[model samples]
Target: MNDSGRAERRETVAEHKRTIILDAARAVFEAEGLQGASMRMIAKAAGYTPGAIYAYFPSKEHIYAAALGESLERLKAATEAAVATGTPAQRFVAAGLAFFDFYDTNPRDLDLGFYLFRGGIHPQGLSVDLNAELNTKLLATLEPLRVAVLDDGAGADRARVVTADVLAHASGLLLLAHTKRLALFGGDARAMMRTHLCERLARGNTPESG
Candidate 1:
């Protein structure tokens, strides 16, 4: 092969190898958590030699971050899909439920994405651009609430605050529910939490009598 052809082939091979390494990393990170996962284990999972994984990612942290980035992207997509068919409040509740559903079904992934942040490594694989993408997705999900909250002459700044509050509440509820500590409310704790939050937000935005 000519130089250009050889370079193109190398690029294709590298891309394929990278994908394999990432897939393996996801599995390992999910099973072992960030601290326990090793490059050798990831390589074995990917059917590659450990050296091959090193060529793609410098450390287990890098692999962990990549797996987390993919997981977050999946989460963002699921939230977007779940909130597409309801009233703003309904969509908000649906988005929260969807998040919990994703975690319940993929606990390892949830651990990789959120629990790693608690370890203090400042995950580096997720670029600033991807961070912006995630923020944009979040803002889109909150847009309906923004409209609802501001419809009664509320200032833009207050609407932004309300949006942030709603998201924070939902995230906190999910984290609690996932930790099994929210079981005091029984099987439908998530539903009850969502309903309570929606009601609170709705009431907060309602025009009050003088």
Candidate 2:
């Protein structure tokens, strides 16, 4: 074909190949964990020769980083969508619920992105800046609620501190729930936590009854 048609076909092939590699990498990471997964295994999963995978990803770590980054971006989008139309408090709750839902739906991706591969491990010399970006996005997501809480009499610093604590608690609760450790708490754990956090924030901002 013509030059333009050839270029379009090449781009489509590249995109398809990239997706195949990512899918294979995700499976390998889920099955073998980050440290245990190998490039050969990913190539095998993708039905590509080992050298073919190298054309797309230089190493298993590179593939891992891409997969992890994609997962986090998807999560960020989900959170944004969840809070798009809600009030400040509703948005906050929606963000928390969206995070939990993401973990529930994509546990393997979550494990690879957040739990299994932490700082200090550079796969194929690939490093991801997920933590800083995630933190910034999360803080921005809470900014409206933060201002509202502070305006209700809580100090700005205090609101930030409490928001950080509540977020940490929520993350821990999600991890526990994902791992099935929260079964003992029954099904209302999320409701209980949400109620407790809301009450604490309101109490902290309450004016003296004098």
Candidate 3:
């Protein structure tokens, strides 16, 4: 191969190794729990030496961040897919439903991204600001829906609040469902999600349904 061709191949190989490291680290974190999961375990799972794993991710906390970043990317893809083609109201509600469906079906991804177990999980080896930055990425994932909501003519601040509120409510409901506590309130988590969006749409003078 030419030098340029060799360089491209090298980049591809590097990306492949990074992906392998991320998948293995995520699995180890899930299987062992963050507290018990170690770099040696992740290295073994990835078929790499501990030093090699560290070459890619400086610490378990960084691997956890990457795992969470992938979860957010998956969510962004799903929500954007739902937003792809719908009436404004339909698209808005679809985005919310997409978020709920993701958490419901991919509980592992949810747990990795959100602290679902309440106190059982905690970040390790990370500064406070680094952790806060993760939520900023989460909000960026929802920006498209917020814009769709504002297309319904919600003012700037209100549209932002509405989007935040919908996500907040969905997170709460999903958390309850994950903890098996939603049933105690006679809540159908999925239905409640749709109804909540519909109500919000109605209040905003947008169509309640597609």
Candidate 4:
């Protein structure tokens, strides 16, 4: 009834439409990928006209970026939660496993994180700034694991290396699992991750033998 109430209602409606566009965009991206997907496809998936979708997102690339941003946020939350109750070493392992588990369970999110499209090696329409912003968001999701490695008493360089190792290992494992190739490596991706983290912890604790 009031002007303020009407404005709030409008804001809510706008946000709802934005969410609808993003949800449709995600499915379209997954199906057709960033290079192959179009605004029209996303609009059809969202049950809106192309003009209506444009009111929310300027391009399919922007929609993909927004979807990936949300996925990274969820990943960060999952990593933080897993690292909350463990010892430093345990927390380090927990963070790595959390990363693996997040991608392993959400294969589409993993695809989004990969930053590749159906017909191209790179996303074409994303601006440099937008790509960098998304990269920063993605790396932020791994910050917990890096911090946990540091808390486990590794030096900064060592922590960085360990964090990278975890990310690379998890990515490889998830790729194998997603493509049904994990059976070639004993078929237990999580167990391999656990073992690898434990080995890294042991090496960190071992005294150098001069």
lDDT-better candidate, 2 vs 4? 4
lDDT of each: 0.68, 0.67, 0.83, 0.84
Per-residue accuracy of model 3 over 97-135 as CA lDDT, tens digit each:
998998899998888877433336466555677688787
Locate the minimum summed-lDDT window of 10 residues in model 1.
116-125
Q: Which stretches of candidate 3 lie over 4 Å from their true place?
A: 117-125, 205-210
TM-score of each: 0.66, 0.74, 0.87, 0.91
Residue pairs in steric clash, candidate 2? none
lDDT of 2 by residue, 1-210 (tens): 999999999999999999998998787777776677888899899999999999988777667667766777777788777766755556555666665667667767657645454333333244546455544555664554565456556666677775676667766776777678899767655675667556654556534311
Report the Cα lDDT for candidate 2: 0.67
For candidate 1, what is the lDDT? 0.68
Find the candidate with the highest TM-score and give its number: 4
lDDT of 1 by residue, 16-111 (tens): 888889987777766776667789999999999999889888888767656666777777687767767766566656666676666667767656
Q: By summed lDDT, which 10 consecutive residues of candidate 3 come out lowest? A: 115-124
Output the worst ten-in-a-row residue range by lDDT, candidate 2.
Answer: 117-126
| lDDT (Cα, tens digit) per residue for candidate 4, span 35-65 | 7889999999999999998888888778888
The candidate with the higher TM-score, 2 or 3, is: 3
